[model samples]
Target chain A: MKYAATDLDHFSESTLHTIPLIEAKHLNLSFGKQQVLENVSLNIHPKEIVTLIGPNGAGKSTLLKILLGLLTPDSGKVVRKRHLNVGFMPQKIQIDPTLPMTVERFLQLGLKIQKRGFFRREYSTTNLEKYVDELNIGYLLKQPIQQVSGGEMQRILLARALLREPDLLVLDEPVQGVDLQGQTELYQYLNQLRHREGYGILMVSHDLHIVMKHTDEVLCLNRHMCCSGHPHSVSQSKEFQDLFGEHTEAIAVYEHHHDEATCDHSHGHNHIHLDETGESKHND
Target chain B: MIEMTQFLVFALLGGIGLALISAPLGVFMVWQRQSYFGATLAHSALLGISLGLLLQTDLTITVIVVSMVIAWGIFTLSHSKQLSSDTLLGILAHSSLALGLVLISLQNSVQIDIMGYLFGDILSITKTDLWLIAFTGVLILLFYWRHWRDLLNITLNPQLAQVEGTAVKTVQLQYILLLAFMIALSMKIVGILLITSLLIIPPAAARRISDTPEKMLLISMLIGLLSVLGGLFASYHFDLPPGASIVLAATAFFAILQLKKAPM
Candidate 1:
């Protein structure tokens, strides 16, 4: 159900033609003496994919949390289109071993019926199944949620996030444990999803090359807004180079190989070895 | 013969009521790794009892109040960054228990059996105690029925639960309050010291036999009921302490389930 946008906020009304789904301006935060984020400003518009790229300790997750309102920034304001629904995929939620939950039930937990104003919508079983089938995770539905393989786990989390039917998807390191093949497929799917649903996508990724191909814009952060622009321009910026080291040139090789589906010969070989070792390690 | 049967009936009903609520609470307590929190509440319960005796108030009511106050106190204190939660729990648990011992001993006007409070005197459960158990059991049932998913979500991840638009803080506060009430009412049947055991062991045993949350809850309740029955029976025939016997029976179930070959 859609409520009439009668009470639209000034931010939305002012930009009547193309209102941003969410906007954060001049965000500054600090924990005691150390500053985590400073003067970070970004806005997500409909059908846009913004990739937040930063090294460890760059406060990428913290920024995402501030955007999601999970944390309160010491200063700066976040504006959202009125009644915006955000589907947040956090980095690695550790489920306790004692809690026995199946993947189907884990997905079901994401089916929260949000009530904003007089409108309400029901996320049905069919919708859940549609996502499950779309992600090819139907096989894993009956298995214990904790026991799924890394690649399958990523798909399952993406499915859970999609179950919310969010206006904007905020994923923090969505492909942390996923293999190279899985990562490419996930980025492709996210791009396709954005085109189909027009949902704004804001995701944080540690890998610059794989994510840069799909990202409309990139924000390079390190305790501040180091650089922000199109992925090409951001990579060209000196600040981005200084922060990420001389790896800027290496992004070209990956970008060239990204289009060729048959270029994963080496990746496929290592993936098997990684999976075996990972499985053995997990058993312990 | 009638009097003996009457006492048995009261004990059984009270035990049944505690078992029903304890399963769900115990499952969550174990899932959240808050068994220590439950123990802390149980420890403070002795303080509640002493406070009741000194003030000439109903022991059950005073225990519930003191438990809630202590639960709230711990909840707030845990937010401070100085001391870890277990450290805080350890401090609160021992100090309140020592204070309770002091208060109980200082009061020369009242005659109280400390052993009964520690290990429980289930056979001596009064009709009033059974009513309190039933009332608390229904209240907890109604609560879980409404917020079962919410509790599960919270257990899985509090931040995710908050993002999903759950009233995480509110649900958590209510859960703490209900847990306080459960511990207070349970102190009489299982005694204050053994209350956490009742809220923990049945679920621990049930974990072996179940593969789903709902199944675990139901199985734990069944296990808890069985322990109560077996313990009461043992107490009658063998002249054992009922609370200790019940806890032992639960441990026995845990051990027995361990012998069941792990599912292939």
Candidate 2:
């Protein structure tokens, strides 16, 4: 098997890592007579981030619901590894103004509800603080969940998902309401988390630049899978352009470096390489 | 004196126990803004009454079965997405009440006490009714105690709950069934029209003072107990209907809480 070996490719050359952590086989879901998703199949491997992109009314939410087991597919099967755990960060959730919930309580609700038996013990608060600190959400812990800004809420939600220590992190619009700077930091943090924890991240996003730059695989869907593969390949495919329009073609790949300060310290001021068409390869 | 004490004790215990169990259920109702949903279920209790009279079986059990069926119907129909939940509940609530009235009117032989069902005569609560309320109360409290986190999670956002490995369908069905049972059992205490008030007002008022969900539930239970006590007292002294008095007392508590300066 001749594999494409390039310095630019970040995919580890490990043939043994073939089994996917999660698999959906030929999923078909319909609402009454109108079919939403048709014969869709997708897979997620350990330490891989796969992004699903589609236009409005294109069954994106339906597909996400199916994957989360919230909606049943008409004629398809989803297989997860035995005892496979998933942490899901949903799209923008609006809490009723009447039900006052602190961010700390909101995060705790996710961990506290994990039904545990005699064998498994729940995570303690002190242990969860580690994730809170890592996500830089410690400041908002005491604040009301409803009062937190959109970016802060996103981080809090991420922190809550991290508490589950899931095998796969499924995020639907993880940075929807955040600005450009916050979005980049979140994506960078996610990339580093995947590398460090060997997690399989599945995210649904409309940000072409971020998905093109960071994701290992991109699946373009318009009811059916139009085109899917490497982000570069998908963006170039005629089917993808047909579904997404030609404007996506000009989105230059934005790559970031940590500089001497490193993300370990507070300041993450970095440089971006606008690789037009991404034909240039990075060494080391 | 001892005989009087025993009678009063049973009534007091039944009312208070029902109030405690209602707290957990009520909190979810308020949080999810499903008071109307509860009202719809409560209204169908009148239908359950007619069905019970028609079946000539255990009235409480028949009521439970009918309410469960209606609750399940509302649940399943809402999933169809053809009609909004409010529209469905509106149709079901009023139509079921109207149907129940028609069914009762058809039975010329049965001189049904319709006012008793509409406005609850708690003084007539049987020993069997007391025991049923106590048993169901214990079951509900246990369900809420063990599944406290699950219930709250589902109420917070069911989609997130599903992702966290909660069996959303099973939990939801259990919740709906329990809600049906509550309405069926409490029909004797607060009647049909006022059942939702007990489920909503206490918790809604509790939100003003509570900073956490658990605290809210506890405070709601306390508030409900107070209302029951005050209502029973008023019924005894003023010869007022016990169900209406209880709901009125609850409304008073709500008004008082609103009047108090809430910590912003």
- Candidate number of the best lDDT: 1
Standalone chain B TM-score for every prediction: 0.95, 0.93
* Model 1 / residue A159 / CA error / Å: 0.4
lDDT by residue for model 1 (A141-169), tens = 88888788877877887788888888999
Where's the lowest-lDDT run of ten residues in candidate 2 chain B?
Answer: B188-197
Model 2 bad stretches (over 4 Å): A1-12, A112-115, A118-121, A124-127, A254-284, B1-10, B79-81, B261-264
Q: Write down the lDDT that model 2 would get.
A: 0.77
Candidate number with greatest DockQ:
2
After aligning candidate 1 to the native by TM-score, how far in Å is the CA of A96 from where it should be? 2.3
Window of ten residues with lowest summed lDDT in model 1 chain A: A1-10
lDDT (tens digit, per residue) of candidate 1 on B148-217: 8889989988888888787887888889999998998888666865577778999988887788899999
In candidate 2 the C-alpha lDDT for residue A89 amounts to 89
Which ten contiguous residues of candidate 1 chain B have the minimum total lDDT? B255-264
